[model samples]
Target: MKPTAPRYDAVIMGGGLAGLTLALQLRQRFDDLSVLVLERRAHPVPHAAHKVGESSVEIGAHYFDTVLGLKPHFENEQLRKFGFRFFFSEGRRDIDGVTEIGASRYLSVPSYQIDRGILENYLAQEAARHGVHFADDAFVRRIELAEDGATHHRLQWTQGGETRDTEARWLIDACGRAGLLKRKLGLAQPNDHDANAVWFRIGECITIDHWSDDEAWRARCDPQARWLSTNHLVGAGYWVWLIPLASGSHSVGIVADQKLHPLATIDTFDKAMAWFATYQPRLYEALDGKRHLLQDFAFLRHFSYGCKQVFSDRRWALTGEAGLFLDPFYSPGSDFIAIGNTYITDLIAHDRRGRSIEARAQLYDQIYHSFYESTLALYQDQYPLFGDPEVLPVKVIWDYAYYWGVLSQIFFQGRLTDLALLGSVRDELQHCQRLNLAVQALLRAWSGASEKRNRAAMLDQAAMPWFAELNRSLNDRLDDAAFKARIRASTAQLRQLAGEILARARDCDPALEAVALEALLAHPEYRGAQRLSAAPQHDGAMLFAVPAG
Candidate 1:
């Protein structure tokens, strides 16, 4: 007689960030919940050269630290990011002579530079300790779904040369781009932002602060900590990123718009170096100095993509790279994973309680899709603006404001699964979403003709009171009503700022077309009297200063 297979509450495919985190979440929420994580890769993935999502932002950080109760691990095992730093030094070598946008000190909110191998290994261990069945080196051959909603999903995989079978009430695809479920369902959707990336890891730190021996320049920052940030070397159609790892290695990548910077231009290590030699000469010189320390190199063409559906009432879902992926410009990979996993967890919780999950799942799916669409608009047609000194800073400020003001507040407030709360703020949230879409369009239009003065001054975000205050607010613990009021005020502030931005765009050139955005902010109270401005003419004048030689 054949042996009987084990049945589990959840079987998550692809034991990367999404799968492992989900397993941990399920086990944490419900004690003794039978969960299985199937990972094709064996245990102990390589350290620094493992995977690409080495950078984490606010939401992902909160998920890993607060929600998952892994704060100690983050502080001890990983490097705290010093916030994002950008240098508009395209085709230039002198780092001092460029418009810089970054903080002089660490931001109040904490993020991290993760070594995927180390983090995943720790996560797997945590899963096992929590009683999750984490099967490494598992080669999944078949995923057969039940046609009737009452039956459980079944799958078969090989582990250590022995075939194993299992049945799961809920099946999740966290398989990255392999998209086992998505491919079978034909849900893969092509997006407009076609970008390519080439990345490698070096067994060393590439500190930007050390590049210039000018003591005056180094002293501009409070602690002179440039290497601790995710630094971007910007150009017209591409940007090179330098992310440091806790393992004493540095992750470098060249992400470019396919139409502007062809994949063949930077397809291989040699070609990438040459391409950097022309577009980002400073990075080339830095890499040239440490060529012998190069550990690994890889590339992917047209990386940005979309999916038709992710969450469903059928007890199956897609999270992370298994469903959709947008551009990696702002390091949103892990952020989206945090978001998607939350929805899946909520739906599973609803199902386990014998509550009706169809309505909740559909609503969650809509909310998740809306988030994807809004974020996608930011990078879809904005690559050319990546190097614009004047426009890019304003864009960055606007983007950061919206992120912290709205989405970050929701996550920080622990409202991801609060359908009732979301329903109550339906009108406000919808208006905010509309404002975001309009602002993205307005920024793209503004960036088209905005002049790049290429002023060589360091714009210290720390000096700007409002900007710094926003960063500080991330740590504030607010009550329900207070959080709602906070979000409302933030949206109002953003609306005024968008109007001022449009005014400046008109000031630069009278012919720009932004009728819709203008209409949204066409009230008389937004007139000549006084509204906040980040420019030098306003109280924000002291934000940027030139370093003495």
Candidate 2:
């Protein structure tokens, strides 16, 4: 007779960040729940260079710190991010002589620059401590998802050179690009945002502070910790990322639009160095001396993708990169992970309580995909405008407002599954989405028609009061009435910002038409708010001193 398979309430596949976190969340929410995490790689993975998602934004950070109760780990083991910093340096050696866009000081809310290896290792340990069954060095042999909701999903795997079988009420795929369930269910889809990326980790720090000799330029940022930020060296059609890890290493990568910078040009270390020499001479010079310190090199073509389905009534789901991935421009990888994991956990809870999750599954799927689509607007065709210092600065402001004002508001208020509140504020959320789409189109148009200013100046995000406050306001605890009112106000803020952006673009080129934005603002609902200016002035003064121009 065949041996009986062990059964669990939840069996999460590929116990990396997403899987491990889901296990912990489930165990945390329901102490009696039995959960197992099967990861392919062994535990205690090498630090600094093990993986690429080394940066966390507001949503991801909050999910890890607050939702999962791992704040202490982040505080002690990871690096607190100095916020995102950018330099429009292309074919330029003078790092301080380019258009800079970033905060002059850290914002009120916190994010972290995570070393994936360290975080994952720590997550594994934490999951075990929290009573989660974690199986490292496990290779999944096959998955047999139940066709009916009443039956358990069966998963087959190998560990210690022996095959094992288990049945689970909830089977989650957090396997990263492997898409174990996604591929089996024929759910893979393609997105039109064709881009490529090549990333590697350096064993030593690629400190930007030493790049410039100007004391004043160095003094622009408080604490003089530019090296602590996720710095982007941007140019036409491409941007290079510099993310610091806690384990005394730096992560670097080049993301480019395939149309302009072909993957072949910088697919290898030598090729990347040569390509960087021409477009990013300063960064190239920084890396040229650290060739021996290269910890890992990897590249992916057409990295952005979509999924036909992630949540299902059949009691199986896909989380993290297994579902879909947009660009890494804003480090949204972990944000999506937080979102998917939350939905999965909720679905499991509903099933455990004998509640019908069929309709809720479909609704949550739609909402999650809507979030993905809204964020995709920020990166889809926006790469072409990255080099336009003026337009990009304004675009960054709009993007952050849309983020902090809408989605981040909902998440921070602990309302991810608040279907009632979300339904009540449906109109506002949809309007916010429309405004973002229009603003993105307007930004692209503005970039095309403007002079594409690359002059040396700092567009200080911290100096903008509304921008800083919007970020700080994420920590506010709100009741239902307050949350609804906040959503309405946030919608109005987006409209006001849209109007200001449209006006600014028209100031540059009066002929530029922003029909969608104009039409949205013309709506009776948006008629009366005082237009709030969220961007800094064009003059290069006040926030920080520019080189004695």
Candidate 3:
């Protein structure tokens, strides 16, 4: 950036995924506006063993592929993920004999196993190519946010033993967990989801499909490409993720409840190996054979957290890890990046047009926080149910249904910035959020009451036409009217499904107590609860397929 070129329109701190993506979005949205991104790390970051969060679900995938127009890079560089796969085998060595909960075939909506280093490098390069200055190896020594009514916030960074200063009207903190602004303002808040993570990268891919020799197990999958999936080896209060990267390395992680599997147990690499031996021995033996291929290992204690605020009226904002991060179980890191970046882009554009932005910023902050809280419900106080194959399968279906049905549709349809539309569907959206909280509570109660159904069978999601169609519908193209209608319909679908799930839980355990769901079902307006709910989706596939009398 030219020192004498006057102030930048926006200065983004910490050129990680969020910072670089914000820079790109700002540059793309306002071509003539000047944007500068500062990063402490040097570029061309080491590939393969770079960073965690390699998996991407629908929301994040749509952001990178469609919104950012990086579809070519996805096709050429990244590995197309085979959807989120989960195995309920806890202690047993044989994965084939366990209950698997994922699609037998690939879902129509595509996501990717992102190589973080590669993706960030591309973002930085793309930003620079588009005239947005991305400065690496620049340490932000001090951040002096603007005072009340101040036009610009001042920032100082050091590079090559020289300190430099600049000012910008808009400042965005995307410094990952560093939380430069979040700490400076004491915006950090305690999260209820106290989970820890220990992750490492292997030099080469670890194939799960080869773990068993049973011909029947081998023949279960059509293509027998389980290795391509973001395979989760799940247990009681923990789950191990095995993600294959296009960089020829596989990313492996163990995320567990702090109460169930403490951080001390898997803090170090050797401890991680030891934990694997106890919890996942088959994987342990595989890694032990090629221990020399271990590339990098790291751990995070209570990995999830929140910020008191992300966007501010003082012309500042925090994105990605600088903001609130719920959990990585569903790989939601990049998806938030997409949403935050989009909101920031709109805010900047609105300001440039001399529009009043304080109210909008406050509203956006509230909406984003709501999204965080709702997503957090999925993991908070719900880890104990992770190992319960019966409850977990239902939870997975409900979680994905909510994701694809509501959030994904809103994002995929680009209705995020449409404040009017969000307002219009306020009741429906609130109902969806309320329904999610209720469903999560009901699932926990059902898990506590129900007997452990240890059936050694795989419940293939793809085999379920309704589940497969829910995954496929994420790729649908809809006009403005159709998009709004689709979201409303999806909300209704979730409500109906939630009712059905509650009824089935009650049926299984007649004495089960689901206060929220029970109250809703008892309401005179709810007629379906008296009967079995079999809500058909757009594909006319029955979502709430209860047993026939």
Q: How far does residue 152 in candidate 1 sit from its true spot (Å)?
A: 1.2
> Which is superior by lDDT, 1 or 2?
2
Candidate 2 — which residues are off by over 4 angstroms?
A: 1-3, 148-150, 529-549
**lDDT against true structure, model 1:** 0.85
lDDT of 3 by residue, 301-346 (tens): 8888888999886889999998888888899998998899999999
- By TM-score, how accurate is candidate 1? 0.95
TM-score, prediction 2: 0.96
> Compared with the true structure, what per-residue lDDT tens digits does model 1 show for residues 121-195?
999999999999999999888888867655588889899999988888899999999999999889999988889
User: How many angstroms is residue 96 displaced in model 2 relative to the true structure, after the best TM-score fit?
Assistant: 1.2
Residue 472 lDDT in candidate 3: 74
Query: Per-residue lDDT for 520 in model 3?
Result: 59
Kindly list the per-residue Cα lDDT of model 2 for residues 1-549, writing each as its tens digit.
Answer: 123789898898988888888899899999999999999998789998788888999999999999998999999999999999999998899988888989889999999999999999999998999999999999989887777434788878999999898988888899999999988989999999999999999899989989999998999999899999999999879999999999999999999999989999999989999998999999988998899999999999999999999999888999999999999999998899999989998998998889999999999999999999999999999999999877888888888889998999999998999999999999889989999999999999999998876777777888877778788889888898888888887887777778788878888899998888888888886678542333221322112222234
- Candidate 1 C-alpha error for residue 313, in Å: 1.1
